[model samples]
Target: MKYTFSILAVILSSTKILIAQTDSLPSNSIVLQPVEIKQYFNKQSILELTNSAHTLSSSTINSQSPTSLTSALNTVAGIRMEERSPGSYRLSMRGSLIRSPFGIRNTKVYIDEIPFTDAGGNTYLNLLDPQSLESIQILKGPDGSLFGANSGGVIRISPQGFDSANDEISLQVLGGSFGLFQQNLGINKKVNDRYQFAFNQSYLNSDGYRENAAFERKSFQTAHQFNYNPKGQLKLFAFYTDLGYQTPGGLTLAQYEENPKSARPAAGPNPSAVEQKAAIYNKTFFSGLGHDYQISSKLSHYIGVFGSYTDFENPFITNYEFRTEKNLGLRTFLSYQNNDLSLPFQFQFGMEGIKGWNKINNYDNNKGVMGNPQANDLLANQQMNLFSRTQLDITKNWVLEGSLGLNKNSIRYETLYPLESQSEGNIKFDNVWMPRLATSYQINNLMALRASISKGYSTPTLAEVRSSDNTINTDLLAEDGINYEIGYKLQGRNKNWLVDLAVYQFEMENGIVRRLNESGVEYYSNAGEMNQKGVELSYWSSWNINTKFLNSIQFNAAITYNHYRFGQYSNANNDFSNNKITSVPDWTMSNSLYLILAKQFQLNITHNHTSSIPLDDANTVFAPKYDLIQARLNWSNSIEKLRTKYTLFVGIDNLLNQKYSLGNDINAFGGRFFNAASLRNAYAGAIISL
Candidate 1:
């Protein structure tokens, strides 16, 4: 990793040569444009943001493999996205994966303005094709003041051009190593000045690098917007996904080093992944409708209604589980602004509510066959958040803001299986208020300083409350914490270079952590106290060179340092006070370079490094450090007579074939810890524009 940093330093040092060469360039040289970041409650320029946020454009996403967002997102500091296997993803923000072993928890996800995360705190982020999104905005650290009940931060995913009125069609096909195949289709049409439609469809399948790790997904999405009134629009959208993946299970250190591509075999008392046909299957459909209206020049209202249904099944080494889940929700908000006064002010108030119903059944897995039932349970969950934000522009360059949210969550569960296991029933958490105060001062057009203090909380997700162990954890508590942060941003003279730096500390109580059982099943328990301190820094620059064959270049580098430790924790056999927090790396860095030559060819390169990670609270074992490199190349041409444009692209992952695990099982029982990642993989694809 030190060597990689040195390479980056060399690249940075060469900037002077490039700058000197470009000083007398022709007039056609490219000039980077200022960026706008919309992650805030109110739209603002990236330099004006008061919190830590990163934006990834569609071009950046496409620079990676056409299948997943893992590589593109990894380039962002403070965010971690893991794929234990294809189509199976787990996400974390600022070391929040401590409680999430398989799915997305503690975080809040939004597709456009719709709440995509269910009331139970689970997000099916893998359901969407990465290319379908126009951009992804991530707000790091806890931001419950406006998003509500999230300790890991917020992810705002914006789909392609909902407001654009262009009639276009495109198709893409891709094939890669390890029996990979994919197809994507995109369509957009402007029926008239008042009506517009956009649609996306994608399919992907892969026989993964390891045995019993095959995966497949079919996704479809559509959006419609109608301008019934001059000042308002009616919008409708739907998303459907049929996704399935095989779980290869975990391996021991010896097995990982010897045969990394092998599946988990039979242990002393457990069946093998292959023998049990370990896999997961899910089919979900979600839809929503909304109306946005401007009642007056100073006030506006927006409302949306949404519903979803999911059919999920999982076959594991120990059991076969089936679940049926449904969600219904509503969201409404109003905004008012007064810019005529000497000091301009704006405010937005909104409320979101959702109800979730789940029915789960678990049966014995007798060698790929489901036997007698073990547990049958029914559960219902409800969550509501009333939030508001007000911002004042005291002097144009100085901004002050205050935000608050009132959150309520409750859950009820009933067990209907083996009558002997009559656990608890209803559980309700008291209403909590989260408030934040922030200010940002623009010292000049090229520099800015910001600070904020906020309160955040996360309730136990449904999976955490009733884990695969078939036992209800009635004593589980919500984790609550306060975060204090200060940040700085600077841009170079020509706006070609931009830098962002943030430092923060968070102290939390009753932190949730994952626990594994003898059969590899998982549960959750509350760790007493934790202190998390971290620094995040990023630099980006883009400029066009003067050479005839060389066109433009973009470079970005980011790093995060975490000093997370347990403040108070103890169990029956150990007291881990002052120990390193589990599943967090002390240092992580990412760098990306994009180059365009002759205006017809392009190349993108990305590199990422992760330091050693503590695997448990005791800090006795660790996952060694590792690095990854991905590169892509593209060539484009146009047909003058056919009015068409096409691109040919090829990319490779894990260029060095480094041996490491993209995801790991923490505190795993029986020394079953490693989940091997793919090595030396390559992909190629073609895109046609019509």
Candidate 2:
């Protein structure tokens, strides 16, 4: 630690000396004004902090009008998003995907400061359409001091918030192979310089590549912002979605080699997914409101409230499941800035709380229909967080930040059918305190260096506690860890190029892992200890060509190199100590090129490569490497007199036609583990505005 600080001090001193020497430029030399790149400056400001963060703007997201979030997020370094099917996704950041199968875990997610991850530590990222989002911010590594208990990281989403512009309506449509189709309608308006309103409705349907792998969705969303007073602002958001998607069970290597497009075969008395109509049906409604009040010049306050309800159903080869879930939450914060002091300083404190209740039932599946009830239970979960943070500028070129977080989590369960006296109970974990200390040293306006050390904590989710095995594991315990990171950033002269680099190491105890039984049911267990070390790098550069054929060209690349291994892992007397972690690739890279032509046309080409991945802790089986290529073309025109605009686009994905498995099942009892990705496909779409 002392060595790190010594290096920082040296860099600071050298930069100061250089600044003194270059205080004035020669009169004969001409200064090249910095080019103004109308991008996410907010993201750059955030990056100046001691944490590693990235932002994906609307332009990057709409580059090809992606149908899923996986496409937009895949370009981010150290983050991996996989889609097992059209509507089913799994996300992991700087960690292996062994703990999650279908949903988001070890990470906290928020939409416009509203918690999308419930009290149970689960995030339904697939619920929101891609078009509804304007930007996304990702904080890499554990950030428990500010975002609460999460081992992986935090993600914040901003939906097209409160646009105060001319009123307009738009429509879009697209279709492609395998019976894919999409249609959308949207409108935005601002009234009296005080109120803004926006609404969107969309429908999506597709017949997937494999049998019994269809998907359908209908969504409606609306937002309103009211600046009714000079000192206050209020914002409201609401959405409803009805979604259904089929589940194509995994296949073994032998089975995949024989017939890659076939679903899993029946075993013993259990029926196949196709025969039992295995699918997920979900309907959800969510609403939230936030208010900001400027109580005084030195102090300000903000409060937000949110609620959600879901009705969900699922049918599998062995049984059928139904659940009704409800959630409610509140967030409040107060901030104070001190202008009276010689140096600028700020202090902030906040509290957040959430509660979730669920009624779940499992029944026997009688050929795609529910038969007799097998298990019935009601579960309640709750969490509360209190945090305080302070920032101070010790000098003109150095800053310090510190924060503390206190968290409490608990759960209760009651059995309602075939009940026993011991089935009704409650489980509570001890409260924990997390702390962070970080520093940032500005070498110059275009370069900065940072370092930090922090503690992390993550508790078991409700599903992991009482899972498909129909057992409540009271012995489960929360995982705890510590992280250390150092990073550097540089912006090329003239602001035409940017580079970000970071290196980090993490160690955790009582790591959680997934397991499956002979009945094909899922459960969780603890792995002894784990260690991870990695490096991440991202680069961006652009060139402008004022010619008749080309206007500008942009290039981006992100790469990750990781080394993860278990310290002391033993499962059923099988020692896996010092072996590689499951489902983690050694290297992953993404590159893209964008071209603007004649100020009215655009072309984009993207490439992605992933190295082989270990399938299990034993590291015996491996999934091969794969590469993907995609391209898109778009043209836009506007009629000024009529106040109208139109755009047409065409795209092709998987242009290389590489056979691959996008979302691979980590471990299986019957050797069923591969989920085939889509083949080469093309899509064309058009949009109209007025």
Candidate 3:
């Protein structure tokens, strides 16, 4: 693998001079206008921000025909996404994956200003397909000052909207190894200059490489925009998704070596995942309406209202569970900008309120079938936050920003079936406040430096407080922390080279963790304090050649290093202080190269490496390190006679065929820690538009 990368690098560097004779800058170069990042309320350019943020554009997202965000986001530094199965996902941002076994926990997610995360702070990101989004912006590190109850930053997704002048329909089909298949249909149109709409529908199915890991999903999304007045507009969005996937339980070291494809075997009389038909079925629907009112040249107000419903069923090895959830939210903000003053400034103030209700039930599983009831409960959760942020241009070369947020969270549970040792009641955490201060100095046109200090807070989710063990832990408390960071950014004259680097440290208190009992039932507890230090770096460069066969070559590389340890922790008379954090690798690196030919054909190669990861809180067990390589080739053309465009693509994954674990079950009972990734796989697809 090293030899291959060396050769590719040599080839790319040699081409710089070879094509100089025939190469010339293009006659027409389309430049992208600087767009606002809504996370900051459209106050300033994302590139000029004092914090670390990354944006993935539409072309970059569609480059690989991704089925999951795991593929695209894996290249980003400080961001890690793992898919245990086709429809199951776990995300970690500047945090370890120990607390997020199934869904996104610490982070917050948004879709066009509508909260994708419910009031309970659980995000169902797997419901939306990759094709439904136009772009994604990620803010790394603690950002609770504006986004409430989060320690791992934020993600804002922009859905594809209608384009009046480019009305068209598109269809896509793709299939690959392990019975993988996918189909997507999308349409956009305009009724007039005042109204436009876009819609997308997709279906996907996969017979995974591991036993009992089949997956299926059907999703639909619609977005509409209405220009009611010259300075005002109304936006509406609705989406529905039905997802089902089987789970292949983790494997022990001995089991992994014997048969990586095998699911977890039965432990004595306990049934395995395969024997119990362990799976998850989720049907969800959400709708949102937003209005932007331009009150004056420098003042505007925006309001959004959203509602969602989810019906979930999970049949695990221990028991079968069912959940019915409903969520409603309202958000509004006002922005005032004064660019006419000597010291230009922007101020934004906002408030958000969310309420969620859930009915949870557990039953015995009789050979993949629901049996007698075991437990029944009802939970209600609520959160409200008020925030304000201001940015001031202190000077032509310096900028200052500050923000503050006040948050409140509460949860109530009622047990319908009370058996032995049962407790039911309401619990509320004390009101919390988060604040942030940052400054940026523009050294020159091509370079800048920034420093920031921020406070972080995260409330335990309902699922963690009230776990699958059919018990509610009212003792769990919210976690709080502080983060300090400094960063540098640089760009070349022609914008062909770019670099971003950041280093930071964080101190956290009352961190929450999950533990398995002798019966293998999971429960949550405060694991004490923690300390973390990390660094992130990214670089990109591109060379353009006007040769007939070759047009451009681009390279991208990113690396992340972390040192996380327990500051003070002891459990069951066991001294675990100063131990490494579980499920967090010490280092991760990613590199990619792209070759473009005559604006018609392109080839991309990517490599990723992860160091060993601790599997248990004791640091006695670890998962081995691994490397991965993938490549893709695409060809596109426009047929003038038919007035249509078409594209064909082929790709290969895990070229090295390394037997590794893509996702691990931390602190798993019975030594069930590893979930093997797929072997070498190949896929092909095509797209047509009219």
Candidate 4:
């Protein structure tokens, strides 16, 4: 494997050198701008404190009209978006799989320091409107010590704010293939020299290309800021999101072979019922307050308090059995920061708390199965965390940083039939501490090298720790792991070319696995040890050429190769080794090219490829590899008198309409179901700005 990577690197390097020779231009050409690691308050507050942080600015976020946040983020390196339905998606980073679509995600997600995950830890990316975002920062690895338990990684999404210098209004309307339509409106006003406010609203609907897949959503946001004085400022913000959607269950291998686009499931001796009816309703409210004070020229203080409340209900059926889950959660964060030191040091200390409650009810046909006059089952959990980090400048060209955090969690479970005399339903977890360290050295103006090592821990969610029944045991253990990474970033002197490369290995102990007993009840267990190693490479280039009226061209490509294997697995009767991990692909790659034409017109083409992955531990079933391509065109102009601008955009996904599968269901009635990727889809839209 090492040799293979080395050879590929040589080939890529050679290709770049050749391209550079052919594209050479005089030194008088467009001068390259120098890149700086700025300490903008918001950006510095997180980047300087974390070992692995990547930021996406608003300009990059709006470069494409993505239907969901996941779609927009998919453009980044080392990030993959997995879709379960039209509006349901999961994000995987650094080879960590987000196991459940409706439960807690392995990766943590936050919007302005407020937890976005529900009671069970599941996050729905579709709830966020990409149009209202100003920036997104992804903090990778086990820095959860500062955030809380389940630190696998953190995704921080920041929304657009008010501007005191302008009064602005904007509107957008869109219509596309598959009965898709979207509308958005926003306004920003500066009431006076000291006060400003911004408000936005959006609605989206789609009759998906696949059967039984459709969705509708609405969102609203408001923000206010006050500049009390040069040394003091205050800001307040709130947002509400509501979503409704239908779940289109997976298809079987035989069904996929017969007709890829068909939504019907295969028949059985007992004829498993096709679950065509599934519904989800969710509502979320979020608010926060922030204040900043400049104690002196070299010293400053900043504080923020934020909270969110979310409620969700999902109902679905399989094999005539109906199941419903109701979840609610509350989360809050309080943080303080100080940046004052001779060596340019910044420190942040914060605490976070979360409370969640989940109830699951089951029914056979119309009859209550167990646990109640209500079939009520409840699980409650509380988590608290404290973390701090600081960076020290060791020299003009080198920097060192370290971080520490602590987490405590408690859980309790209850059932309506207390008389059943079940074992202890309450579990208290001990506080866990995590730490990280890293260093970066600048080799020159255009190159840098960095290395990082961190310890991370992930606590089991309430659903994983205390489910409704023993059929699916919830007593799974938490995961503890260590990550080691080293990487380099390089850019050409002209700033028209760039390359980033990284390699990492992670070792996890006491990983959780699910097993079925003789009673046909699925139980959780601390199965075995595992290791994951991968390499990622990315390249980007932009250049201007005088050919066929084309002003410039931009291109980007990235690929990640992962290898994972289990070290041990022991069942009651036997032990196994060298089992390949499930649902993790060995190879994934994506590339895009953009052509900038005259008159604010442009065209973009993109392609993605993923290798086959084992669906089960036995490696008997596999999801085949496939390739996809998409194209887009955009044009913009202004209404001169009104000082307003308009943009018209169109896109075609899966231009070839190739039949492929993007994900599969491992927990179908018989564990034999899959979801086929979309085919030949199109979108068109218009944006009006003032």
The number of the candidate with the highest TM-score is 1
Model 4 worst lDDT run, 10 consecutive residues: 365-374
C-alpha TM-score for every candidate: 0.96, 0.93, 0.95, 0.86
Clashes of each: 0, 0, 0, 3
What is the C-alpha lDDT profile of model 2 across 212-322, one tens digit per residue? 889999999988889889889999989999999999888889987788777777877778888999999999999889898888887888899998999989998778989
Model 3: how far residue 407 lies from native, Å: 0.7
Which order, best to worst by TM-score? 1, 3, 2, 4
Model 2, 307: alpha-carbon shift in Å?
A: 0.9
- Looking at model 1, residue 176 earns an lDDT score of 97
Per-residue lDDT tens digits for candidate 4, residues 92-186, read 77644424423335577776645665445556677778777767777666666566655357787767664335487889788887789999887
Off by over 4 Å in 1: 1-34, 422-424, 518-520
Clashing pairs in 1: none
- Candidate 3, 226-254: lDDT as tens digits: 98888898989899999999999899999
Model 1 per-residue lDDT tens digits across residues 1-690? 474477458556755534443342223322232367675555787677888888887778888888999998888888888888887788888755678778887789987778899978888888889978877888987888888789878998877647677688889999999999999999988889999888999999999999999989999999888998799998888989999999998898899999999999999888899999999999999988889998999999989999899999999988999999999999889999899999999999999999999999999998878998999999899999999999999998999999999999999999888788855479898799999999899999889999999987999999999898987788899999899999999876556777788999999888998887656678899998889999888777776674688777778888888899999798777899999898888888888888877868888889998898887768887889988999998999989899999999999999989999877888877777789999999999999998
- lDDT of candidate 3 at residue 412, scale 0 to 100: 87
How much lDDT does each candidate structure score? 0.85, 0.80, 0.84, 0.64
Error of model 3, residue 504, in angstroms: 0.9
Error of 4 at 61 (Å): 3.6
